[model samples]
Target: MVKQNFILFMLIGELSKKSGVSRDTIRYYEKMGLLRVSANRRDNNYKEYADNAPDVLKMIAIGKNLGFKLIETKEFLEFWEQNDTDNERLTEMVLKKIEEIDTKIKALTVFKQNLENALIKCEP
Candidate 1:
């Protein structure tokens, strides 16, 4: 009795295949409140996800690409979906991430230079 336009529902394996995110990561995100908490439960207790789950995964990926941790990404997405005014809190998060990256770059540069120096010492 399903219509051609009916929405598709996917189980964890299908979602993992469609979204390219592992089932473990999906489960983690679901536990962490990033994905839909009320995934439709079948009589056997298996969860069914909406077709749009892939899009949500993409949003999470985009947030991580912006240097946000999983928890931060969830919070940022919530704030973004609900807020309209000045995003000072999000700005602060971005600034802090930038500072962290800067410190890491400095340490990495020093480490690279040390490695180069060590290699030079080994040259004949």
Candidate 2:
């Protein structure tokens, strides 16, 4: 079977398609310094994105999955970009995230118990 060549460079629209994020969201990320682009004003004039744009999008998705607000995600991304070699710091961040998740889980468990108790008292 022949392998298709993956495109390395993409325009904003194509990146949006590949990233599962709206163009406006990508633009907002760009404004917030979470993403960067290169433009070819001589030809197509549209912004050119790096092959790593997908990774950036994945980071955003991961942040959302971890219950981080956008601003918090931005700050985390900034820290990640600056401290690639600091494994200890990364571990600390991960531990903090785990703690936050634990807190949320406890709250959810309490809420579920309250709901179940109320349901047990309800008439059919």
Candidate 3:
């Protein structure tokens, strides 16, 4: 098959190995429309994914590492795949996530301080 420069069309197992995402998660991604197998491939029981499928899985992994929910990752992927998508929208999601993380950190800091104060009182 004539391949794109560095892109690879691969079955789920090879894709999973290359992408470090498991088969079950890849199936879940297909179910969620995060990944897709062609209709012919689906019908023929020959599931070959498009070349960029691995990249999508990597992006999902990055989003998860950044604490984005699955839905958020889906939205991010949709936005990213759009031809006219701009950085502003992506920045908005990331900034909002950072704000969320900051809020959680503040709450956790307060909780830790409260526990520390309680421990101090108990020690005396």
User: Which one is best on lDDT?
Assistant: 3
lDDT against the true structure, each candidate: 0.80, 0.78, 0.83
- Clash number for each model: 0, 0, 0
- lDDT tens per residue, model 1, 58-118: 9899988877799888877777657633688878877888899999999999999999999
lDDT head-to-head 1 vs 3, winner: 3
lDDT of 3 by residue, 11-114 (tens): 88888898888999999999988887754444457688878888899889998998999988998998877853677878888889999999999999999999
Q: Which stretch of 10 consecutive residues in model 2 shows the poorest summed lDDT?
A: 1-10
Candidate whose TM-score is highest: 3
Worst 10 residues of 3 by lDDT: 1-10
Ranking by TM-score: 3, 1, 2
Better of 1 and 2 by TM-score: 1
Ranking by lDDT: 3, 1, 2
Question: Which residue runs does candidate 3 get wrong by more than 4 Å?
Answer: 1-8, 83-88
